[model samples]
Target chain A: GAGVSQSPRYKVAKRGQDVALRCDPISGHVSLFWYQQALGQGPEFLTYFQNEAQLDKSGLPSDRFFAERPEGSVSTLKIQRTQQEDSAVYLCASSPRTRTDTQYFGPGTRLTVL
Target chain B: QQQVKQSPQSLIVQKGGISIINCAYENTAFDYFPWYQQFPGKGPALLIAIRPDVSEKKEGRFTISFNKSAKQFSLHIMDSQPGDSATYFCAASENIRGYGQNFVFGPGTRLSVLP
Candidate 1:
C-alpha cells in the first residue's frame, strides 16, 4: 500500500510570498491532519480534516494559514505572506477513520522563508 | 501552553543497555497515549501505544509503562541497539466524538545508541 506523501520536499520563499504544500493521503483514508515541526521540536498540530469536512482549525498559528481537502483524499496547506518564523517542516498524516488513533505520516515538506 | 512534558532532551546508551524516556501530562481527560519514532529526513511512525486501562504493555523489546494516578508514562527500550537511535515523541489525546481529539505532544527526546 502506498504511504502518505507530500510534494515539493523542499521549498524556499521570500518573505511576504505565498506558498502551498500538497499532501496525498493513503487511498481511502478518511482522516487527514497537518502539523508543523520546528527545528529540534516535536510536530505540532495545525489542522485536521475528516474526509472533505474541515473538523478542526484551532491549532493553526494565525490567520495566514489555510487548509482544504475538497476531494477527501488529498489536502493542501497554504501559507500566505510567508515569514521567516514560518521556516519549518510541514508534515501530513492520515488515519483509517475518524476514531483511529494510529496515524501514518508523510515525509513532509520543508519550507524556508528568507 | 504545552500540555505534555518530556524529560531528558537527549540520551546516549551503549548496545545491550537499557534506555528509558519519561513524559507527563496534565489533562486527565486524555485517554489515548501513543509514542512516535522519527529518523532524520523522515516522518514520525507509531512505535507503540497504551491506553489508561493498562498499567503496562510490552511489544518485542519495547515496553510502555503508564502510571495513571501520577499522570505520567514512560518508554523503556531493553537491550538497546544502534539501529534504535532516533527521536521519540510522546503524545496524548482525549477520545471525543469517537475521534482522538487535540493531541498534545511532548518536546521529544533524541536517543543515540552506540555499539
Candidate 2:
C-alpha cells in the first residue's frame, strides 16, 4: 500500500500463449513506465504513460506487446503469441509528477515462456 | 538508441573496502544520471544520482562522480558492507519530450561484498 505493487510475481506461460501483467502505481503518482529485462541485462523501456494518456509505445518490441493505463493509477501489459525469447522480468515504475521526480519501482513480475 | 555501458560485470569486494563501478554513455543530450541498486527478486531502487552540471555528488556512503567531457560516471561505495551486495545499474535519460520516464539502463554490475 505504501509503494508500487505488481500481481503474479511469477508467471509460466507456454509458447504461443498470451499473458497479462498488472501494476498498481503509488497513489497520486502521475507517471508510469514498463520495462523488460532479460537475463544478465538491465531493464529496457517498453512503454510510458502520462496520466491516462499513452504518450509513447515506441519501445514495445512488437504488435503483440500492448499496454494501457485507463485510469492513470493501474496499468497492464499484455503479450500475445509469446515466444521463448519473450521470457524476462517485467518491471513497473511510477513517478510523482514531473520528469525529474524520483521513480518508485515495483518488485517486478518474472515471466517465463516455456 | 542511447546506450549506457557499465563495466566489471561482476565484482567481489571485502567488507570495509571501497567498491567502485563505472559507466559510460553515448548520448550528449542525457542530463540525468542515476545509479540503482537491485537485490534478487526485487526491482532496482534509486541509490544515487548526479546531473551533468555538477562533477560529483556524495550521499553518506555513496558517491557519484560525473565527467561531462568524457560522458563517463562512476559509483563509489565507501566502507562496503555485506548488506550492500547486489546488482548495481547505471541509467541515463533526458527530460525532453517527457521522455525522462524512459530510462536507458546499463548492463549492470553484480557486486558481492564479502564479510
Candidate 3:
C-alpha cells in the first residue's frame, strides 16, 4: 500500500474484555510504531519495532498491553482486560529506516471501553 | 515523563493573521524536531521539520524557529487560512536511536482560523 493502514476503525469493548487492533505499514517500511491518544491529547508513544524486532516497549502503560510484528510487516496491538481509561485512539505509523526519517500515520483505531 | 511541553491548548486566529505554537523540551539529546498537522477524523501529517543545526527553516508559508540553547522550538503559520485550522503537534527525537525510539510529543495546540 502507499500508506500505513489500520483495521477496525472503531471498536467498543466491555470492561475486562480483550481486544486487538491491527496495523499494516507501508510496503518495505523498516520501522513501525504504536501510539495512544486520549481525547484532546497528543499521541503518546507506546512501542516501536524495527522490522520484526520489538526494540522498545517502554511506553506501554501496563503488562496487559502487548504488541507484535512477527513478519516485520503487519502488526497487532492487543489489550487484555480493557478498562475505561484505556479508551483512546490507537495510532500506527511507519518509516523507511531507523535513521531520522519521516513517519507516515494511519487513520487510527478509536477504541471505546464500556 | 513527558519530555516535551506545549502551550496555548487552543487558539483563535483571524484569516491572514499569524498563528504561532510553542514547544519546549527537557532533553538535550533530542536533535530532530518536527511539527504535525491533524484534522478531525484524520491522522496527522508532517508539516515541517528542523534539525538542531539550523536556527530556522521556512517552507512556503510555514516556518520553524529553533532555539538550541533554550531547548525550545516554535511553528509559525504566515497568512493563516481557514484550511489551516487543525491540531498541531511538536515532536522531538534523537538521531542515535531508531526512527521509532523514544520519540516525544507535546500535548498539542488546536488552532481555529476564522474568516
Candidate 3 chain B: minimum summed lDDT over ten consecutive residues — where?
A: B94-103
Q: Whose lDDT is higher: candidate 2's or candidate 3's? A: 2
Q: How high is the TM-score of chain A in each model?
A: 0.98, 0.97, 0.98
What candidate 3 gets wrong by more than 4 Å, as runs, is: B97-101
User: Tens-digit lDDT track for model 1 on B1-115?
Assistant: 4489998899999999999999999889898999999999999999999999999999999999999999999999999999999999999988778445667789899999999
Number of the candidate with higher TM-score, 2 or 3: 2
Ranked candidates, highest lDDT first? 1, 2, 3
lDDT of 3 at A21: 100
The weakest ten consecutive residues by lDDT in model 1 chain A span A94-103
Write candidate 3's Cα lDDT for B1-115 as tens digits. 4479998899999999999999999888887899999999888889999999999999999999999999899999999999999999999988653444457889899999999
True contacts kept of 2: 0.74
The parts of candidate 1 lying over 4 Å away from their true place are: none
Model no. 1, DockQ: 0.76
In angstroms, how far off is B10's CA in candidate 2? 0.6
Docking band of candidate 2: medium
Residue range B1-115, candidate 2, lDDT tens digits? 5989999999999999999999999889888899999999999999998889999999999999999999999999999999999999999988866555458999999999999
Candidates' RMSD to native: 1.1, 1.0, 1.3
Which 10 consecutive positions of candidate 2 chain A have the poorest summed lDDT? A96-105
